[model samples]
Target: MARLNFVLLIAVVFSALYLVRTQYESRRLYVELEKASAQSRKLTTEKERLQVEKRAEATPLKIEKLARDRLQMRTTTPAITQYVEYKTAPAVQKASHE
Candidate 1:
């Protein structure tokens, strides 16, 4: 009878320890999940902000101004246009061998 009681006590202790370990692991995972959610929210806000800035920077007037200022480009005009002619070389005739 005493040996049976001892075995039962050991089982109970092991079960209690396992429950505590499981609870600790659950809490740790919950904390990590919360952190990841917060990070996701932060990344979403940043993406929205960058999108707004992109829209502002890509306005047609802004693009035209940047093209004119950064690159020396101008609209085509008849005054600056020139015409060129193409000439082909005459073909050479080979002498017949006797």
Candidate 2:
């Protein structure tokens, strides 16, 4: 009878230990999940902030200013504009007339 009681006691202790280990693992996983969610929220807000700044930086005036300053480019004016005349091949011109 004492041997049977000893076996039963060991089984109970093992079961208790397994339950504690399972609960500890569950708590750890919950903590990790919460931390990951917080990180996701932080990254989402940062992405939104960067998107807003990108929109602000991509305006037409900003692009023109950067082009003028960095590339030393100028907008074309009528005074500097040139006209081009195209001379077609005689065979192609004749085909078009026909």
Candidate 3:
């Protein structure tokens, strides 16, 4: 009877320890999940901010300014325009044998 009681006690102790370990792991994983969610939110906000900045940077006026300033481009004018002519061989008229 004493041996049976000892065995039962050991089993109960092991079960309690297993339950505690499980709870601890669950809490740890929950904390990690919260951290990951927070990071995700932060990254999403950063992405939105970057997208706004990108749109602002890509405006047409800004592009034109950059082109003129950085690339030394100039607007086209009729004074500087050139015309090109393309010449092709005259078509050969085939003699028709009646």
Q: Give the winner by TM-score.
A: 2
Flag regions of model 3 displaced more than 4 Å. Answer: 83-98
Better of 1 and 2 by TM-score: 2
Best of the candidates, lDDT: 3
Model 2 scores a C-alpha lDDT of: 0.97
List clash counts for every candidate, in order: 0, 0, 0
**What would you estimate as the lDDT of candidate 1?**
0.95
lDDT of 1 at 90: 88
Q: Please, what are the lDDT tens digits per residue for candidate 2 over residues 36-80?
A: 999999999999999999999999999999999999999999999
lDDT of 1 by residue, 1-98 (tens): 99999999999999999999999999999999999999999999999999999999999999988888999777779999998999888888889898
Residue pairs in candidate 2 whose N, alpha carbon or C atoms collide under 3 angstroms: none
- In model 1, which runs have C-alpha deviations exceeding 4 angstroms? 81-98
Please state the error at residue 84 of candidate 2 in Å: 3.9
Which of candidates 1 and 3 reaches a greater TM-score?
3
